[model samples]
Target: MKIYDIPGFPNPLRIRIVLAEKQLASQVEFVKVDLPAAEHKQAAFLKINPTGTVPVLELDDGTRIAECTAITEYLDNLDGDPILTGKTARDKGVIHMMQKRAESELIDPVGIYFHHATAGLGDALREYKHPQWTARAEWGKLQGEKAVAGMRYFDSVLEAQPYVAGDAFSMADITVWAGLLFAHFARIDVPDDCNALRAWKERVDGRASVVNPA
Candidate 1:
């Protein structure tokens, strides 16, 4: 299997964390997709993911999977233990719910702010951006605000629990961590009052799975 992604990008980083957690790093080859060079928009690359996104997984048999959530689902379910996503029906439902919330409330909004309000990946990716990006400065700023709100929401979540989805580290935690990382790149700081969230990140950062990715 091959994982095609640009290193350090938030979405790719999410899957990288998943690979580390699942201990599947050695099972797959990593293929670098040079986003700055606009390689993702090229016809050959688009053949794999018409949406032109990174963090795509291509199986040895030529099966292709895209989207960080879907890729994480595949990786998490590859074995019987099911650590990241969940182990039981209720756990699965809650983890999936929180994961989607993390994406919708935090990750996606920050991405919108980066691609629309900011200069994005410079002129190289301009042709590939959505047409609405041209006139969405105000909307993108709103998204930035929404990202902050999302952070506060998660801060409250952490205040009550050790992790995003109850006691165990799961995909929801990965999504929020990725969102915070993207927030850092986009100059959106976590609020000073959100100490719970800040401490949660500190714990997540110290994990071997995150610090020493294969």
Candidate 2:
């Protein structure tokens, strides 16, 4: 299988981290897209994913899989492994619930505030390039602050558990890790009160798959 990735981007990195966690690194071929060049916007690239996002998986049989969540779920269903996404209905529900919260409350809002207010993808992504919004930096900053509150809530949940969905390190953890890692890169501050989250984050970061993928 072939996977298209962008090293610095959060979406691709999410899958990369999961690939490491699953020990599937060596099993897949990686194709890196030049994000700064806006290569993803080209028609050739769009054929694989109409959305033109990175971390697209192309099976040897010519089937294409895109979106980080879907890709991770696909990996979970394949080969019947450790069941990170969950082997039971209750586990799946919990994992998906946490995933939903992390994505909706933290990930989406933070990215939106950053891109729209800070002109994050202005140079590479044409759609979000509106200088008028940059002038509303304060408003965007407030949105970021709101996002941080959600992070705190998420942190509280993670503090008591080994992973997002309780004791198991599932795709929900991967999703949260990718978002928080990207938020750190984006220069957002993590609250000092979140000791559990901090500790958990370190544990996840220290895994061999995350640190030195095969």
Candidate 3:
């Protein structure tokens, strides 16, 4: 198996964490997806992933599966019963719910703010240029602010639990970890006042797999 990835990108990080947790890092090959020059927009990549998103999984038989969450689900359930994602129907329900909430509440806003709203990446995303999106740029900045508030709610959740959804570290934790790291890099304040969350982030960051891959 192979994984199309980009370091510093949250979505790809989610998949990488899953690989580490599953102890399957050595079983797959990782191909770096270059976003600076818009390599994902090139025809070669479009052939493999129409959406041009990173973290696409390539089966040995030459099939490709895109989207980070779906890829995480695939890897988690490989051993059967969807342990990390959810072992029971209720677990699956809450995990998926919380995961999506994090995306909508925190991660998506960052993407809109950093990539679409800011003119920082003038030449990096050549293909995304459009009059409509240009007009919507200001919204991204405001959305980023909202994302910070949403993340605080997450901080509160972490205050009560060792992980995102509950005691056991699950996919939700990976999603939050990856997204928060990106926010940190983007100069977003993670509210140092959230003592519990601050501590949790430190612990999660200590995972060797995140700092070094197999």
Best by lDDT: 1
Alpha carbon deviation, residue 96, candidate 2 (Å): 1.0
Best by TM-score: 1
Give all TM-scores, in the order shown.
0.96, 0.88, 0.90
Ranked by TM-score, the better of candidates 2 and 3 is 3
lDDT of each residue in 85-188, candidate 1, tens digit only: 88889999999999999999999999999988998888998767767754688888999999999999999999999999999999999899999999999999
What is the C-alpha lDDT profile of model 3 across 13-59, one tens digit per residue? Answer: 88877887788888898899888778887899999898876879998
Among all windows of ten consecutive residues in candidate 1, which has the lowest summed lDDT? 126-135
Of the two candidates 1 and 3, the one with more favorable lDDT, higher being better, is 1
Query: lDDT per residue, candidate 2, 6-104, as tens digits?
Result: 776777877887777777888898898876677888899999898867889999899999987788888767778646678888998898898888788
- Deviation in Å, model 3, residue 207 alpha carbon: 2.6
Look at candidate 2 and give me any clashing residue pairs: none
Which regions of candidate 1 fall more than 4 Å away from where they truly are?
132-134
Assess candidate 1 and give its lDDT.
0.92
Ranking the candidates on lDDT from highest down gives 1, 3, 2
